[model samples]
Target: MNSAQLKIHLLCRGIQLDSSVDLDADARPILRTRGGLASGIEGILPGGLSINIPVYESFAADSPFSLVKKEEKYYVFRDEEELSEIVLPPNPKFYSKKTSSGKLMSRIGVMQGTYLGIYPTDICEFWKTDPPSNCRFCSVGLNLGSTEDIDKTDADLLETTLAAMQEEKITFVHFNAGYLGGKELEILEHYIELIKKNTPLMVGLQAAPSADYSIYERLKKKGVDHLSFCIELFDEERLKEVCPGKSRTIGRKQYLDTIEACSKIFMRGRVSGEIIAGLEPAEKTIEAIDYFAKMGVVSTVCIFRPLIGTQYENLPSPKPEDMIPIFQHLYRTTLYNRIPLGMAPNIKVSIVMLAEEGRGLIEKKGFRLRLCEMRNSFIKFFISLYFKIRIRYGKIRLGL
Candidate 1:
């Protein structure tokens, strides 16, 4: 199977690792902090397709796929049959390094694919309410303070970011905090500025939307390269049911409005609307994608993984066949809209299927798709050049 297809299948049906596969010795640890959505074995499929395969989820126990090491090389197997060879992203020694504040760098920030992901604030307030109103599929509450530090100082964030950039040669530093009252953006701004001020690495923030649209503009000025608004469900009622805190506090209209506002502020692909596919109907998910596409906002579609301790732990993961259409639509819409995907250099996000990666799911691509790719190639060149200039000059903001 192709790399993207393998990525989709592995995401839908979690994979089991053979006992011989020592992740600690050979791979990046399953650092399951930051929204608790991911806790999986990470591997890079051929052609640079990096993925986080679910390994610890209950569904993974019976996965048809398994990772086995043979002759010191790792390969995924189907039962006893070898399927494909894979390599684990190295467990970087920087993870063991400590920030200036004595906090372990791994606890402060961990690599999610090629970028350093940091949840530099307290746990989402949704998980701390009287009865707990967290997202049904989120494990951030259980994950924070257990695998990573709960509250990371600005120094910790800067330290971890610099270490990852220096050692991993990372291109971006992503900061995602769970809901923090209405102050999520306000709280994130400090770290965003800190990172921008010190390093050449690009910054992306995924937080509960700010009540004020202007906060995004200020953040862009401060140096947020990208912004992701998790409007998890498109269907209003499903959103209410699945993300009670988001629906009540931020509201469905507000999320879309914020996304719309940012689209005008940032470049086409730089603004993303993240939606969890399995929670809402596939049709709704498509509508959500189209909505974002029309506004020049790329959709960051995350497959609904039934995280272990979340409220939806017992839920079944979506089948790969069922999700195929959703992703196929993802590639077509993004390409047709002329929104560039995979333009940023060395960014391979494993948590969800990227718009560009959806190319593998589509059975056919006509000249139209080819033309878009060609146009995107020029854009990618310019983007790479821009990043080079930014890294050298430091503190250059997107003219958007």
Candidate 2:
């Protein structure tokens, strides 16, 4: 294969391999391939490549990697190959600690691997009325059903989140609750209030769009460092089909409008939207990313991974090769525009690299000076154009 075809093949291979195991030995090849390196390429690199892998890996684990528990051992496998095996992270010290009110800390919330995740409420009116209204990619109902308790109070969540931060050295806190239908705004406010009263750490919240701007202002005041209101799709018709619940509840135009309003309020870098790559037309996603970039909202493009018990379980996921160009373009645009790094706190290294290159242009003299200035001013614009042409000719490539 030529370099272009080779690049595509490598990306495809990266996407095809599932790397959800905890051990580095099992995940390295998938990481190398995703980074556009030869599968066996050995070396250390810079920047925040490790962070992006988790979101995609989370999706991959649900679809491809199967976890089996036999007797005392937990094993992760892909088909017949036993990739890696290990015991789960020890329950944190805080799990055994409880609030003065007597709620179990673990039941309120817990640290999963590296993330501080909380499901304060497991009931969504959307799920109750019509399951299809839910995002096609989400397994919220399945997760809720498998777990015993249905609701966790705001006070309990606050206590647990605070304990995790203080005792576990946790840096980020992520919380998502079930959609409350007519009570969406009110319940969200309760969560924001509780989190603010309890912790000073960076916090993220995900919920269906709300009708009131005041609630958003309250959340911002409550110390919400980042916000993700996922549209899930750029195409209107696709939204109707893939997220019927969200579409009917929030409406397509309202969702986009809310994102626009959020960009204005949260300002660039603090605001973000999620786009499921495999579900929508690639061109539509490109358009959406560019549109969001101009609006100062970071677009997080995640590959579609069919969840085990979801409605789409029997459907196939988009091949990794097809997702490479899109991911590359998205990352390049994000870097060039200086989008705030959101959850990936480690992305500062890459931003510093781009900033230094921009500064280098300003220091050059004569024709070089003018050329560098032009490059510096339109870094994102140029990168977008470059990727557009490269992808059109099937030459797009990424080095992680």
Candidate 3:
């Protein structure tokens, strides 16, 4: 399909999609369209869209493209027929087991779509005060405050994680913790060590930079496959305004320094930095991506989605058109450097599709325009979802 046609198809599909209750506003609609539950696109295509299911075994009986029903039947929909199917991954016998502390092992960590996401600590230090010092994009602290007994001790986390590995065939395990008072990074190290000691699964850790090199050494010893020091933004002035607590705790240079140090330890193609798109000027984002690429770090460009209770709630998301070019540039740079798209699986999936279609053709100096169409599709899906939910829910208040 032509780039223009592909962009239009993606936007239309994204807008008409439906979702399950648990999916975030944006993902729900996209899931619906993907599942063939939503309407439109009857005549435009030659025999409907093709869905490729990633092969992995899990207790969950549903295919990636289909949803499981309450009646214990798998539902698969196509343009002409819907089929009742049975697709099963060997049930991890360990899933039925509990931790020594009597916590349900399954509840300790969750599989969000495809990724195994675990929260070591649900509380952030910044949330303890008025006008909390947490990052503007985070809702972890607020969510933790609303719930009782949110903390997952290091032992329990490790035990449950081990059980998950034994029971579920997880491809990657992602560990994210709330900002601990002063020991956030330290606590993360403990969990990392335990996981390293126990399993050989791919591990990705996200946290602010630590105070010392020893922590990095400890992490390396524990077998961290990927590391993300989320600097979040590149504009120094904007960094101060948006993430004052982070700015004070770890300055931009220090954050960059940490990534450099980690890159040295982890080596190129293994270290990454996170940059939230739509938060700073296009130039700033471009500069950060180029800088990270030069330093052998993959720049994970996340679209700035304002969480329900964060400070930037009223702000509008950057239009997809605005972010498409930026994504294309970064994707092409990484491709040129032979950097495997690190830990950001979803973005990699989309970009790979674009690359496969020979969209990496247009060039303005060093930047390419081929991936923009696909990038814009992702952006449109997210923005449309963001606005729809905001309008319906009217500022979601996490019961903090």
> How many residue pairs clash in all the candidates, one count each?
0, 3, 1
Q: Please write out the lDDT profile of model 2 over residues 1-400, one tens digit for every residue.
A: 2222222222232223334433333222211111011122111122111111222432343444344444545444456665444243344677667766786666566453344666666566666773246666566665553432356666677667767765665555666665676565566667776665545445677677776777788788877767777788899999999878778778878778888888888967677777777788799888888888888887766556554456765566566556655655565565566663333321221101111222221222466444534554465455445534533332112111
Give the RMSD in angstroms, all C-alphas superposed, for model 3. 13.4
Q: Which stretches of candidate 1 lie over 4 Å from their true place?
A: 392-400
The Cα local distance difference test for each model comes to 0.85, 0.54, 0.53
lDDT of 3 by residue, 40-78 (tens): 111111222222121111211222233333343333333
What TM-score should be assigned to candidate 2? 0.65
Which is better, 2 or 3, measured by TM-score? Answer: 2
- Backbone clash pairs for candidate 2 read 12-321, 133-244, 133-245
Ranking by TM-score: 1, 2, 3
Which candidate number would show the highest lDDT if scored against the true structure? 1
Is candidate 1 or 3 superior in TM-score? Answer: 1
Q: Sort by lDDT, best first.
A: 1, 2, 3
lDDT of 1 by residue, 151-214 (tens): 7887887777777877887888898888877887888888888887778778899987765888
Give residue 101's lDDT in candidate 3 (0 to 100): 78
Under the 3 Å rule for N, CA and C atoms, how many clashes does model 2 have?
Answer: 3
Return whichever of 1 and 2 wins on lDDT.
1
